[model samples]
Target chain A: MAHTPFERIWDRHVVKDYGDGRSLVFIDRHFLQEATSGRAFDRLRAENLPVRRPDLTVGTIDHSISTLPGRTLHSFAAGVARNVAMHKNCADFGVRLFSIDSPHHGIVHVAGPNLGFAIPGSTYVCGDSHTASCGGVGAWAWGIGTSEVMQVLATQSLILRKPRTMRATFNGRLSKGVYAKDMILALIGRYGIEAGVGHTVQYAGPAISALSVEGRMTVANMSIEFGARGGLVGADDTTFEYLHGRELAPKGAEWDRAVADWRRLYDLGDAMFDREIEIDCSTLGPQVSWGTTPQDVIGVNETIPDPSSIADPTRKAMTERAIDYVGLTPGTPIAGTPIDVAFIGSCTNGRLSDLEAAAAIAKGRKVAPHVKALVVPGAAHVKAAAEAAGLDKIFIEAGFEWREAGCSMCVAAGGDIVPPGQRSMSTSNRNFEGRQGPGSRTHLASPAMVAAAAIAGCIADVRTMMH
Target chain B: MEKFTVLTGVAAPIAMPNISTDLIAPSHFPGKKPEEAIVMSFKDKLFANLRYFPDGTPKPDFVLDSPRYQGARILLTGENFGCGSSRETAVWSLQEAGIACVIAPSFGDIFHDNSFQNGFLPLRVPADDIDRLTKGLARTNASELTVDLEKRELRVSGMAPIAFDLPDNRRIPLMEGLDQLRFMLRSADDIAAYENRASTERPWSFAAAGG
Candidate 1:
């Protein structure tokens, strides 16, 4: 039987096959940033481990560095030692660094794809949570721990345990205001956070088919929140169209050949998966995370769940804890709870479209006086696009703190944070307790909603605020 | 290099998805300094909101919260389990919480790698097997999972022998109790080999042959 191109890529990367169903996967493309690599590589040096394959790996400043397009990264500055240290560290490790001024500069997620470093059917790994975003291009990508960060740093390959296969199929057309974010959030609400543990899920269905490469990334980026090794989609025209003219995408005759090859990437008809889940996107509403976990969520129109309605002690305890931490009673609805801050940025939903969507709502509207609003672009490319479109001026005019790109508030780093005890509307993944900042409650929403909240200073319906 | 012992055991099921790092160790007010809860098992606390098929209906068949599935080491769950941001708290929470092996149809890509690195067995079982385990948990109340890190095979009794995708270089340490940090430290000879190769293959990489 002939294997698909995906399998071919898989076979090529298989460096060593261990008995008992394990194999050594040699990573061809390795991506890293200052925030994690700085510390991880330092540890590798402490252990005296020299990098095995410098040619196979690529390093850049993403998580902790800025996305100010065209700005030279000054090595000397106050409170910029970490950034300086990262440059020096990458130099010491012989890793090629894509610094701030590089046209290729952007968020790690955006930079990889924009530069065509992320190719079809390749295994991509990054030192960030949203690395699954690469799955948009048919690449198997995921995040790695700090220690594993050191491992990949020393050697381009990572030791991985094979994952069980699962097929999560969602069929149906999406309603307006309900994007890919809503589809995933609906799955979370239906399944909860722990529904898909120990599985490598392949998203297949009519709805998943209609999604763009960007949208597919939005879903794959959150696979970790669902607890899967990697989320993937079969290659199709959308994958090809996005790759066309892409910085790293093959060109001319090579592009035609690559497309022909990518067209054949699919699972066998008789191929069996470890698990299967099916969902319908037609009924999905705007999703919002009311509790700490992504799965502890509800549709925007729905009210916060009452823990008493849940008789299970374990679930009840979890709900109660979330309610207490979020300072809302279960019976009292999450809709009315006020928001103090609104953030729109992160590897997820920090693209040009997300910025534009937020900017549209920010225009002609003033952010509430009490609210601290921020619009952090995902990458330098996104920042440049937003600036060209004048979206930054809209955000800044509407009282949002327009700043440089980086992970920023998504992980509650570099001062893009929610104040203690304040609830924030964020356009990033994860809403765990203190995930944004110590004692700072977070409510996960779409970029549109983040803009609406920034204007209203509370969780107002983005659609309602549009007019 | 120090050798770490592999502690093998039966996989207790605490099946649920979207197990983020916060559930493992909440980004609480306290810092990373040693604390009682961090040192203690985080299973119960970690599986706080774990529910089965949350379509506003109840399915009393969950691994961590179920009485019948109690003490069963293997946790069977749906696909995309452990999806979301890359937070090691999820790994620490499960590893410390007493789940030696997590058997699911899928796993969060990053968390899957994190699990192997941390010395816990995160197994991938067929979807049918996952459903079967869930049913078995409800029927005979048995869902035993055995993970032999040395053998690198997960035995779920009724389920077929499933393969794990691990790197060859990583397999040695995992089976021999060498983690990433330890592997780097122990392979002093290998590091030297690469360094010596680097001097010639990419002369700019090294300032001088001997400095």
Candidate 2:
């Protein structure tokens, strides 16, 4: 009997199933970052246990790591402790450490796939919530707390409650300016934020198949923000093409065998899902978050939603609160909202394709004098690749700062923050109030939208700037 | 981890949906030292922005700042509470601030799991029940609530003890106050056997280093 893609991966990874809902699932790969791993490593040492599989684990300096040039551990006064702890712990445990100096170092979610560690048809985890980005390669990946991290580091397996499957099908072609970011933001906006909770979502259909593997990662990276534990797209020729020459990918006959196995993992047309939702991407435009949560979004041309227009009382109250925090009036068009900064990076939209898109819009254009624009690559390889492609020159010429790879400005933990009372158009996954800084307002958008906003010095429609 | 059989406290209603970890305990504090991160317990940073302003002055309008809910040990919240980032510090902060139980309609999966790991109770009550409790707490001057884990019920004044669901595996840990690692180690032999079989069945998945 054939199995759905999600079930096939789960069945293969289950070490012990008690004929019940819980199972001890085998973890194929484990990734860690500085902020959360320190405590887990401390717990393991306190218990006097060696890592069960060091070779399968990789540690990187992200989250609190600095993206500033010539950054040392001491350069960031507030981030140095975890930075030092992470280096010491990785060295002590024998896990492959991607130090700040290493070309492999970047955001764990991005570096894992770039180096081919996040392979197809396996279970992976990290102590960071965006670990779902690994699902782009058809891997079953999700976040865990430090306690679960300690368990996996010591035993190579975790007890998991079986998640109900929810498949989100995007059924039509995305418009010219509309991107994977827009599609995902639109989905979260249309459905409530908790729509995908307690479920592992399989993103399938013509639109998903059309997305490049990098595009799929952007969708999966934000799956947590949409309330899914994980989100995956079935492996296809597009996925195979992306992984064919990757560093840790299989070689020769092994590659052929792997492809054959991956092909079989695709869901059968009649495969069942506990719940299914379909979105028509054909009409979707470039979306922007007008309020605090990702779900409080509208198209670039649409006006801010009035509280009265929202029928759900809870949502109405939330909208009112968010508008007060964001300092926006009801019915104001989102396109003209003033912004002081534009950031083009994060695990969400920091991939090569994202850079290319932003660079295309930025060619021969300069950022407005009032906007502080930045472009931090997702990984060192991405930085090197972009430089080789001269995307760096394009961005610099456009007045955007081209920086080293790290989780910079996406959160305040990184020390690169948008100032208080200032608005920012960012390519990051979240738009929570004060998320960028104290009293800092954030609007989530695609990289192109960010670049366009940088040029215009406020929120601007990318469609108008394109071509 | 302290085993929690029952918890009775004055409940405060923070009825907004999607209250993220960043809000519960902010990741960034102005001019905070790197060494300070290790020394500052989550309790010091609990609702940093809401409880205090930039100059460290208390914010009067915030729920945690109100006199009525002072020392309130239970938080009643709306849907998708604890929605962003896997910061365990949020759980630690709530626990440190004397909040032992968090009742909501639903939660972000990681946050829910983290709460259990830290011996904090995060119960998922029905939306209507949550609404009733939030309104009831506001209506009454002194409102106390009780959460009984053994019976999986929430009791409030002038209302029925609303029943909630918890998987046996999750419940067992909280009831026994056992860390997940300690509990899993009880079946070491089975784990080893499963590993041996997994190595034989799926060798490719183990090849992370690329020999």
Model 1: CA > 4 A from native: A1-9, A43-50, A65-81, A267-271, B4-175, B179-211
- Tell me the lDDT of model 2 at A133: 93
Could you tell me the lDDT of residue A190 within candidate 2? 89
Q: After superposition, how far is residue A75 of candidate 1 from its true place, in Å?
A: 11
| TM-score of each model, paired residue for residue | 0.74, 0.96
Candidate 1 TM-score, true structure as reference: 0.74
DockQ value for model 2: 0.59
- The DockQ of predicted model 1 stands at 0.16
For A1-467, candidate 1 gives per-residue lDDT tens digits of: 44433455566555455554655565656787765566677777787877666664666775544333333454212216557887887788777777776666667887777666776666788877778788777777777777677776676566555666777889899876667777777776787666655556677889999988777877877776776646777778788777788655566776676676566556445556667788888887677888877877877777888988999775787788788778877655556567888888887888887887788888988999998888888777888888999888888888998877777787766545566678889988888766776567888888887887778777777778655
Ten contiguous residues with the weakest lDDT in model 2 chain A = A1-10
